[model samples]
Target: MLSWALTFLIIAIIAAVFGFGGIAGAAAGIAKIIFFIFVVLLVISLVANAVKGKAPKV
Candidate 1:
C-alpha cells in the first residue's frame, strides 16, 4: 500500500516535470488516498496487536 503511494508520487513528479497537468493532479490525488489508507491500516494493525497482547515481531 505504501509502495503504491510512493509509486503514484513518483508518477506525479514525472508528470509535472513533463507539464502534464491533469495526469499530475490525478496521480497526486491517488498518492494522497493511498497514503492515508496505508496509515489507517497501520493504525488498525497496531490496535489489533495490542488487543491480542502480542509484542511486535522483531
Candidate 2:
C-alpha cells in the first residue's frame, strides 16, 4: 500500500512535469488517499497487537 502511494506520487510528479494538470491532480489525490489508508491500517494493526498478549508460534 505504501509502495502504491509512492508510485502514484511519482506519477503525479511526472504528469505535472509534462503539463498534465488533470492527471497530476488526480494522481496526487489518489496518492494522498492511499497514504492515509496505509497509516490508518498501520495504527489499527499496532493497537490490535498491543491488545493481543500472546506471541505466535513459529
Candidate 3:
C-alpha cells in the first residue's frame, strides 16, 4: 500500500520532468489517496493491537 503510493509518486515526478502534465497530475492524485488510506489502516492496526494489550511487533 505505502509502496504503491511511493511508486505513483515516483511516476508523477518522472512524468512531470517529461512535461506530461495530465499524467503527472493523475498519478499525484492517486498517490495522495493511497498514502491517506495507508495512514488510516496503520492507525487502525495500532489501535487494535493496543486494545488487545499486545505490543506491535518490531
Cα lDDT tens digits for candidate 1, 1-58: 8999999999999999999999999999999999999999999999998889957799
| lDDT, candidate 3, 20-39, per-residue tens | 99999999999999999999
lDDT for each residue of candidate 2 in 4-47, tens digit (9 for 90 to 100) = 99999999999999999999999999999999999999999999
Which parts of model 1 are misplaced by more than 4 Å? 54-58
State the RMSD for candidate 2: 3.1
Q: Sort every candidate by TM-score, greatest first.
A: 3, 2, 1
Task: Mark the 10 consecutive residues where model 1 has the least summed lDDT.
Answer: 47-56
Ranking of predictions according to lDDT:
2, 3, 1
Per-structure clash totals for the candidates: 0, 0, 0
The lDDT, on a scale of 0 to 1, for candidate 3 is: 0.98
Better of 1 and 3 by lDDT: 3
